[model samples]
Target: MKNLDLKKHYIFFIGEELPQPEAHLVQSTNAANAAANLGYSTVLVYLQKGLKAIKPANLARPFQPRETPTELVKYYNLHDKLKVVPLPMPWPIDNFRSKFTDSNTIASKYYLPFHILPTTKLVHSRNWNFVKAAIKNGVPAIYEHHHHEDKPFELEIVNNPLLQIAVTVVDSIRETMIANGMPEDKVIRLHNGFNRLFMQRQPEKAAEWRQKLLSNERSYLVVYAGALQQFKGIDVLIDVAIKMPNVQFVCAGGKPPEVEHYQQLTKEKQVQNITFLGYVLHHELASLLQAADILAHPHCSGKAATFTSPLKLFDYFASGTPIVATEIPSLIEFKDTRAIAAWCEPDNSHKFAECLKQVLETHPRKIEGYSDSIEFVKQFSWENRAAKILSYVEESLRPLLIT
Candidate 1:
């Protein structure tokens, strides 16, 4: 615990060690990869609880020269500077009440409970039990958090305050951190950025997904891509689709079960124009967005909507298409909304439909203000976001880092 080995930059992440596209997987991967690529000795410690339902990388078979990128763990081996330490629990733990033996009690320290999910019980990450060990020796730390259902570990941060910096998305979360005992200057608001992997498009991509999703390259499609959870306002989107019978409405991201639920809703409601394409990869998703006339963000007012910045917004901005989003807290954070999205009040199906119709009819490409978003979105790239965090980290670690 005396002189620290500052050679390796350690980031302790408490979550299931799943492949890309899992809840925190993409963001964490981007952060670590960015740090590694930027010439830092990066190590990500993934804390995994041995829940039977949790699945590790499924297609991660023995390597093949001609194997698809998705088949293998792409983040591994590619980055020389980055290392991953996965701590998997021996026993299964579904909730806080689950009995833990002496050997497996460490799992409790890495688990963060979600009050929204009935299965997840009251539990905060046992940072005092594990994360303290990393910092006790003077290894500087960064805690990146988004809005969670319940943050039991906020108390830990309030009590210990060992984190060098805390990166957050929403203003409310940042305020909460300061109120909960994290220093005001220590908390940084870093909104979600358009992923570089998705933004980098293929030459033939523009032509492929346009025809594939809409069946017509020239169709004026209004697209919404993200989860199909209740707070996402997918039902409101279906309502808008019903009103605008002529225009095509397409939704691209959802789990199989969630997609099926919406499909059933559409069928029961006799909605025909709206199409639900379940879970398209980013490469294909980028193309689909580029071809669309307008991008829709039908976010309802809720906990998820309040303190978290959705990644889809940046994707929508990068697409060069006009955005129509519900007037949620995140969208308004920019202050200047004229150039970005056609903002409307939440749960207003009539208003949303009318706004979409107007935007579609106006032919947003020709409009003067619509192109402003393209310029504004230049700053919202993953590389830029990662660089910002890295800049902060470097400054914070400079005094502590030893050669």
Candidate 2:
């Protein structure tokens, strides 16, 4: 922290551990990697202690001297230029803390902002507490919100003079923030993006995956990739698989426990056509997607459905495969829904199966309007998203720099 020139450095603060299966970790690490690739002197700061304390194996191993750990680089496919700094948690308090007074919260809220304030030109983070702390200390900060829930003391935080911007992943979130008195000019809606690497199609690799995934009986493959949560409509996907006995349905993302639970659920329901591939690497996702005949986005309706932006949706677009998705508010707002996907009603397995059947029967294996989807997704690349956000920040801070 000593020799850093503030003007040359940009800090991205995250409260979670890297190399996790969560979408947030994927989004944050990729954004930082994109910023670094754009030639910003970027540093990604995360906690050494996550929601839980470091494991015994991690304790036994010596600390990594490199700026970015090897595991993280392989896991997230991060750029070498991006620096990673893990802030240590408070000693005894972290070792022993109650749920109400958690150490991760303490470090993120109180320690991280002060630690990076003097070292960085601008702070970008999804953690509201970290952003609030940075803004309170007069450091320029950009806060990105993904969820629909309102933060405590939201108005006070948004109105801070040093708060450079507030970014939301969907229009509903932006509208909600504005309805709560956040300045219209200070808030922007930017969707989560797909990695640029996804655009590079690996035909041989995709063929290999198709060979491995497809069977003699089931000539067509329908794939869904992302968290295997109930809200994400994995249950509905199962029902769809049950209805379509001859088509192979594969899910390509989930933790081990989640995979086990769903596998058990399938067994109980006697659903034979479905398979779950737990936690595929980010780099391999593109090839896996290309192997699919059709990609499914079956998110259910509820509070989460209103504001959630599925990262996989962008990747699916990039895959050049036809998409079968539910007609949720978030998907409807994209304007290109009809252009990129075949829509069905949320939480309705019968309708979803009928929609998939229509797509399968109509297209064979190739996608309709494939060129349009590819062209449309060009603007939603990770590099473009990062550049747009960074440019806005620089433009907003120009007057401050002039003075």
Please identify model 1 stretches exceeding 4 Å from their true place: 1-6, 12-14, 20-23, 45-133, 148-161, 201-203, 215-218, 335-338, 364-371, 394-403
Off by over 4 Å in 2: 1-7, 50-67, 90-95, 98-101, 104-115, 152-156, 335-338, 366-369, 394-403
Best by lDDT: 2
Q: What lDDT is obtained when candidate 1 is compared to the true structure?
A: 0.60
List TM-scores for all candidates, in order.
Answer: 0.76, 0.88
Clashes of 1: 1
Top-scoring candidate (TM-score): 2
Quote model 1's TM-score. Answer: 0.76
| Candidate 1 lDDT, 1-403, residue by residue in tens | 2223323343435455545344355566655555555555444445444552244441132111122133213532123444554544444343545446432344333321111111111111223443443344334456676764333444544344445566888888887767666677787998877655444444366656556656442366788988877788898999988898777889987778888999999999999888888877665677677767788988788766776566778777766777888888876776475545567788879999988878876655422224566667778766577667656654535322212
Query: lDDT tens digits, residues 102-208, model 2?
Result: 65566555554545555567788888777877777767888887776654446777777678778888888888878767789898998888887666777888888
- Give each model's whole-structure lDDT: 0.60, 0.77
What is the number of backbone collisions in each predicted candidate, taken in the order shown? 1, 0
- Residue 93, candidate 2: Cα error in Å is 4.8
